[model samples]
Target: MPESNTTLAIRVQGLEQKVPTLDGELQILQGVDLDVKSGESIAVTGPSGAGKSTLLSLLAGLDMASSGEIWLAGEPLHQMDEEQRANLRGRKVGFIFQSFMLVESLTALENVMLPMELAGAEDARTQAENMLQRVGLSHRLDHFPNQLSGGEQQRVAIARAFVTRPDILFADEPTGNLDQANSARVEDLLFQLNQEHHTTLVLVTHDLKLAERCVTRVQMVSGRLEAL
Candidate 1:
C-alpha cells in the first residue's frame, strides 16, 4: 500500500489497464498517477480512445484496473473485493454520464429515490423531492425519462446523482448531448452544487470550456497522463 494522504480524496499510482486482444495485450492506460485533494475539481480532457472514461470508472470503482493502486477517501480500492468496492461506492460515490442513464420506466422522483431506497434510507421520498426542487425539477417529478426532453432528462440525472450527496462525484461528458443553452445551465448547476456541498469532482470531458471551469486540468494522450 502506498502512503495514504489523509487530505486527498483520490490517489492513483502506477495505474494500468490492459485487455487481451488476438494480436496481443492492448494497453488502455499506462502508468497513470494522480492525486486529487478533497473538495477539488479536476477535469480530464482527451481525444477519443484516450482512456478518459476508463480512468473515471477506475476511480469510481465501476471498473477494475489490471495493475495499479487506487485509494478513495483513504480506502484502498484496488485491494477491496468486488462487493466491498460496491459497498464503498454506494456510500461515497456519485456519477453522471454523457447519455443521462436514467431508468426509462421510473419517474424523475423515483429515479432520484432509487439509490436512497437501495441504501435503506429512511427519508428517501422527502430527500428525492427536495433534491428535485433544488435542481428546478419539482414540476417534472412525475415525468418519465422518455417523456422529458434531452435537457430535462439530464436534469433528472443530475438530481439523481446529487441526491445522495456522496463525498465524490464523477461526471463523463455531462453536456455532450445538450445544446449550448442547456449545457451552460447544467454547467452552472454542477459547479454551484459542488461548491455548496464541497464534494470532490472528477470530470471526463472533450469540451475545453468545461475543462477550464475546473480547478485543475490534465490532458491524456495514448493512454498516458500529461500536464496541460
Candidate 2:
C-alpha cells in the first residue's frame, strides 16, 4: 500500500514529562520538539535515563505528557484521555517492546491474531498465518512462547506488531536481547516491513549501527532532544 495523504505522521511541540520525587518533580523530557513525515524512519538514541524511551512512549500515546502538544497522524493526543488514547493506539499504532511481550500461554498464531481479532477483522486467522510465515515462523504457529527460543519469540512479537498494518510503528530496543545473528534478522525484518507497508517508524535504541539505518537520528541528553 502507498503512504497516506498526511505529510506528517508525528508532530510534538514543547513536550515535557515529569515525575514526582521526594523533594519535587523530576523532569524527564523538557521542551522537546519533533516532526516525523509519513513513511519516514527515525531513531531516538541516548544514554540511560536520557528520556529516549519516554519520548517514544509519549509519541505513541502510551503515556501522557506533563505539558505540550502532540499530534499523531494529525490527531490531538495531548487533548485526549486515557481511554481515547487507547482507542487511537489500537486503531493506528503498533508497538514492539524489547522484552518480546508475547502471551506465554497463547500459540504463535493466536498471539499474532490478537490485534486483528480485537479490530473485528474476520480473516484474522488467515492473516496471522501469513504474517507468521513472513517472519519465518510458519512451523512455529502452534508453539507456545515458552517452547520457542528467544529469537523465535521476538519474531512472533514482530509478526504481532505488524499484522494490523498500522499507520505508525514504535519499537523500543527491539534487538536488545538478541544475539548478533538474531539482531540482524530482526533488523532486516523491521525495515522490510516498514518499507513494504509504508508505515512510519520511530525506534529507540542505544546501538549506533542500528540508529544509523534510520532516515533521521535524534539524540536525547539530560531531558532534551537534538538532531545529530
Candidate 3:
C-alpha cells in the first residue's frame, strides 16, 4: 500500500535546528518536512556533517529541535515540555545508538531487564532472557559489556532495545562496529522483530546494503532531505 494511505507514525514540518558556536549560530537542519507511516521503515543516509544524527535525535525525542513541528505517534513533541517528551518516549520509543550505550556495571541479562523493570513488568528477567536468547546471546547472559566482544555488545544493545517492543525504533549506525556475519544477523533480527510487532523503523546509516533494505530512503545534504 502507498504511504499516504496509511496512518502516519511520524510527522514533521518546517523542522530547523540551530546551535550557538564560537563564531555564531550553526544551522544543522533547515525546513525539513517528512512523514513516516505506521510500520514503515526509512533509512536516512548522508555525509558525516549533514546532520543525520541530529535529525534522529530530534525524531526520537532525545533532544529538542530549535524550531519546528514534530509529531511522534500523534504526540506533539514541540508542544510538550522535556518531562512530557521523556514520558512519551518511554512509552512508545526505542533507540539504539552507534556507541552501544550499555551500562558498564550491568551484565547482559541485567542490562536488558532494566527497561522492563522500570516499566513495572512482572516478568522482566524472563522476558529479557528470552530476548537475549533470540539474539543468540544465551551463553553470554552473565557477561559484562567489557567482557563481551564489540559484536556481542552490539547484540546486547539490540536485545535491550527490542525487549520492550516499542512502537517505533530509531537506530543510529546500528551495525557500524559489527563484522559481516554479525551485521547480517543483526539485520535479520531487526526486520524480524519489526515484522512481528509492526514497529516503525528509522535508522541513520552510511552502509549501502543496510540502507537498501529499508522500505524508503532519503539523503540529507546540508540539513535538507532529498528522496532517493
Tell me, by lDDT, which candidate is best. Answer: 2
Error of 2 at 148 (Å): 0.9
lDDT per prediction?
0.93, 0.94, 0.93
Candidates arranged by lDDT, highest first: 2, 1, 3
Taking all chains together, the TM-score of candidate 1 against the true structure is 0.97
What does candidate 3's lDDT look like per residue over 146-172, in tens digits? 999888898899899999999999999
What ranking emerges by TM-score with the best candidate at the front? 1, 2, 3
Window of ten residues with lowest summed lDDT in model 2: 1-10
TM-score of every prediction relative to native: 0.97, 0.97, 0.95
Residue 99's C-alpha lDDT in candidate 1?
98
The 10-residue segment with the lowest total lDDT in model 3: 1-10
Considering every candidate listed, which one attains the maximal TM-score?
A: 1
Q: List the residue pairs that clash in candidate 1.
A: none
Write model 2 residue lDDT over 57-138, tens digit each, in one string.
8999989999999989889999999999999999999999999999888999999999999999999999999999999999
For each candidate, how many residue pairs have backbone atoms clashing (under 3 Å)?
0, 0, 0
When superposed on Cα atoms, how far off is each prediction in RMSD?
1.1, 2.7, 2.4
